[model samples]
Structures are given as structure tokens and as C-alpha cells.
Target chain A: MTTAPRLTLPAVTVGDRLPDLPYDVTATTVVLGALASRDWRPMHHDKDFAVDRNGVRDIFLNTPNQAAWFERYLTDWTGPRGRLGRMTFRMKGSVFPGDTMVFTGTVDEVVSDDTGCGWIGVDVTLSVGGDLKTSCHARLALPTTDDDNPWSRSGDRWTP
Target chain B: MTDLSADIEALIGVEQYEEAGEFPVERGYVWSTCSAVENGNPLFWDDDVADALTGGPIAPPTMLSVWFRPHHWAPGRDRVALPLQIHFDLKEALGLPEAVMTENTIVFHDPVRPGDLLTTRQILRSVSPEKTTKLGTGRFWVIEVEYTNQAGALVGVESYTGFGYRRAGSEAGVAP
Candidate 1:
């Protein structure tokens, strides 16, 4: 298996744009995310309930499902050593099956804290056909050197 | 007619409910979640790789709340109710027929691991006055949910915001 390259703190720039991740959303994808997150909400898996009861077009992604997707998107770019500190997102619209959701992100800031933990700020947006569905702001910790692993830090050294 | 505005006003900053997950964190759950998201992070799949970084394998930090999500059905539970009770309470009180999540924020304090029994407590954060938007006339509310492990250490906290609204032409009242 080919391993993804580790992203070092010194390599990231304030304006670096991560590669776009486009996913063809499907009913199965929606249901899988809900089931994996253990969210049994009907709006995420029951099309009839979503259409007839919830008045939505169809079953859409749940909150945790979206969170998982965001995590995947960020970690994919940061490789395995990246650690998420916090994330905030706004859902402006729904993502239905048959829509192609494209994730785009850019590095807004990069900093090294007093504890020597390297942090990267990212702003991401999920859009379908150029219409915004969700916008997320996230902060993540990355390694400063090859031997530096953010996850290995704890106690006084792990303030994120 | 019930005064939803008044009722919701009284609920702000009050603890709505506290509950524990049906089961502890399981490796199978971590696997399924990773598979669903198509994540190939060694931290979630390869123990040796994770051990070098975090002492052992760790669940995705975003899964903090997932560990506390109650099962759909259990032996003792005879009926099914919506997961977040406070959201539905505002919906029913406001006569809103539909609700949608508008915003969410989560702060991760610790990594989750298998066998960790998680519990969550939810509190009503704020409630907005009724306003008309593209979706319809509705009030927005935010709920803060805190997650803790069996040892009572904080794992994460989430602020969830939702809008309960009456669709256009729906007979539901939005209160004066």
C-alpha cells in the first residue's frame, strides 16, 4: 500500500490550497454514514420519511455524517499525524442523493504555540454545482519535524 | 394556544437531559466509521502505526459524540423518540412541522478508544425570537452537549444549532 506523505508544519503556507475532493453522493452513501455514526435519524436513511414527513427532497446527510466527511477531508490532506483540535460548520442547505459534493479548502493561518504544537487553520466549503451547502472552519495540529508527532503529546504539552 | 415563545424562553440555560450510550466504544464501530468515510488513516486501522503516535489505536476525534449516540432500540425501551429531545420540544411547542440543523461546533479534548463507556449531558444554550427567512417563519435554538468518559473525564463538547419552522402554506402557527 502506498502511504500518504506526512505534512510538516514548515511545508504548509498561509495560502496553500488543498486538492479538491469531489464525491458523487448516493442514497447508499448517505445511509452508510448515518449507520456508521450510529445515528438512526430517519432523515438520513428513510427517503419516504424525509420526503413525506420531513418535507425535504430526500434523505440527506446527518450532522455527524458531515462531521465525519470533514474529518476525512482534512486528514486526507494532513496525512495520519494530523490531529483535529476543533471544528465549526454552518449548514446552509441539504445534500441529497444524485448531487456531486465538492470539498475545497485553503489554509488561512499557520502557527506554533507556546507548547511547540504546530496548528493550521483551514476554511472549507462543500458545494454542489457551485451552490454552497456547508462551510467549515477547522483547526488542526501537525508535526513540526519528521520525528514530531502531534498525537504523542499529552498533559502540559498538549494544549490545543 | 400554547405560548411557545414563553415556554422556550424558560428553557434557556437549563439542562435538558443526560444519557449514556447503549454500549462502550468498540473496535468494530471504529472500523465501520472509517470505512464509511473511506479514511485510510493508520491511526484508525493499524495498531502498530497508531502505537508509535498515540500509544495505541484511536478513534477519529470527530467520533467523540458518536460513541454516546443511543441505539435505536433496546430490550427495555418500547418506544422510539427523536435523539435530541430539546429540539423536538421546541418544534412541538412552536407548532413547527419541520426542523433543520443550521450550525454545529465541536471541541475535542481527548482521544476516544475502544471499551470507553461514554455519557453525554445536553443543555439548552439559547433561543431566538421568531423570524421569517427563506425556509419560513421559525425560531433558532442552540444546544450544548458535553461528552465524558466512564472515569468522568471530559472528552468533547458540541454546540448544535437548529431551526424549527413551519413550511409556507402550512397551517402551523408560529405564534404572534
Candidate 2:
């Protein structure tokens, strides 16, 4: 439904470490993300505007840009079956062009439910050169085994 | 004990609202957003794939923030939307004109379908007192939003956190 349901490892457990993803934050990504989210704030794309008006070194990432990064990380790890339940994050500093962001996380909690789904929590961080830029707490509803599709359920049945 | 704290204190529970009625949910926008992020989730675009689950194409849950977002132009296409109201004013009053959004929490209660006209309201939740972090001393505040479709069905909710801070200095709230 939502995910591809392609490859899944054993049901995740607490303390399981996710793969480390190191990416270069480029000007294209910064600007594209702003456009995609429809966040027209100049600081996200116009370097001159950022430094001249906002007082940052260069054009930087926006909230939706950061959200995209986290979204990709979660879906990539859980494959297509990982349904996002809730996500909470805090921005600590700015992520600028030429910065390499390393994403890492650990499984925080897992709850087995009768609805044939497993609710998962992951605490994650996005850092550049060892300086933390963002921290997030996310809840994902993952299918148990292959047939457990969380997307087909009605709104009244959504899990917490 | 920084002067910013008291100014921020005056803002707790103050709310500002921007309303958009009966908005269209376009497939192109959803496809573009998912494509930009490199998310291959077929549910966003493939009707055959989506039909297998949602009975129709479904928007990515993360797009909840995008739909019903107020454009730079104010409603009725009259003029540029007024400068961000409470958020900008609070930051200015605190003398921390420079601020960053450090936290966001979004919960999806319902799937967004293609062509669903959505409505939403955003509220200013709470503003914390000045706190010192590695970045600097600043105030953290929450903006809560609730989304519903034209049928009056709930779609989702989001709590976005903004941390407005000044550079660290010798002040009591500045982090070392």
C-alpha cells in the first residue's frame, strides 16, 4: 500500500543500530527541498539573502528539508512496510552547504499488538563533523511478517 | 533571569490562526515532493499499486504539513500574507531576531486522499523560559496545528518547535 514491502529483516528490537548514512548537503538539495515543501523562505536558497538579511554563512536547510532527511532514513531502514506514526525533532543548529550530515540512530521501543503490527520508536541524530544539528524521536508502525499491512486500515483504527 | 524570558513569558497561550477552505490535493505536487526526497513509495503516485491497499492513490503522510499551508499571498489572493505574526513578533521582542526551528512533531490520524479538500488551524501552544544550549541561550516555543478534510474528518496534527537564540556570551543563560 504505502511501502514496497520488498525486503524486511527480522522484526526490529531495542538497541538495534541503524546503518550510518553520510550525505553531503548541497545547494541544490537545500533549494529543491524548499521548493518541494513550498517553503519560499529566501534563506533556504538565496545565499546572498541568507547572509545579508538572516545573518547566516550561507543558504541553509529548512524544517521540511530536515523532515525529508528523517523520512528517507526511516523508510529506507524499515523498507516499504514501515508506516510512520509520529515524529518529533529538535533543531540545534544550522545545516549549510558543503556540510556532510551523518545520520545514525538506535531502536528505542517496540510494542507488539494484536492488530498484527509492531509499533516502533527510534531516537535519531543528524550531525556534521561531530556537531549535532538535529535530534528526532519517531514512532513507526511496521507490519509483522509480510502480510501485516498498516496502510489499509481505516482512520478510526490508527495506532499510537 | 534574562530580559528575554519575561517577554517570552507574556506570549504563552497566545494563538494566531490562518485559515484556507476547501483546498485541492494535487497528484503532481505529491509526486514532486516524494521525488525530491527520493522516496520511491508507490502509494504516492502509482494508482495500480495504491489500489491494492488504499483503494486509491494516497499522499505521503509527511505531506500533511504541505497541504493547507498558507501561501505567501494572503487569502482571497488579495496581498502578500502579513509577516509571520506571533512567531516573528516574539523573536523580535526577545532581541533574538535570529532563531532556528529545532523540533517538529507530526502525527497522522488519517490518510490524505487525492482531491480531498482539507482545512487546518494552527495554534501557539507554549513558550518555554530561556534555556542555554550549545548553540546559545534562547527560548523554545511550540506551534500546534490540526488538519481536517472538507467532510469534517480529522487528518492529522503537528507540533512544531522553534528555538530562537542569540550567540553564547558571558550572560547567565548563554552556554559555554
Candidate number with greatest TM-score: 1
Itemize residue pairs with steric clashes in candidate 2: A3-A80, A89-B103, A90-B102, A90-B103, A91-B102
Regions of model 1 farther than 4 Å from truth = A1-5, A54-58, A155-159, B1-11, B14-16, B92-98, B136-138, B165-176
Per residue, candidate 2 scores C-alpha lDDT tens digits across B1-176 of: 33445655655665556565435888877877877777776666567777875677877788787765456665567644422356666666666756776667888777888898887666777777778888888788787777888788878888777887887763333322
Candidate 1, TM-score vs. the true structure?
A: 0.86
lDDT, residue A99, model 1: 97
Residues A71-109, model 2: lDDT tens digits = 888888876557788988888888998999899999998
Would you give me the overall lDDT of model 2?
Answer: 0.75
lDDT of 1: 0.85
lDDT of 1 at A36: 93
Tell me each candidate's TM-score: 0.86, 0.80
lDDT per residue for candidate 1 within A1-160, as digits (tens), equals 2233379999999999999999999999999999999888789988999999889899998878888999999999899889998999998899999999999999999999999999999999999999999999999999898878887776678776
Candidate 2 chain B: 10-residue stretch with minimal lDDT: B167-176
Give fnat of each prediction, in order.
0.73, 0.53
lDDT of each: 0.85, 0.75
Candidate 1 lDDT, tens digit per residue, B32-74? 8888879888888887777777787778998887776767778
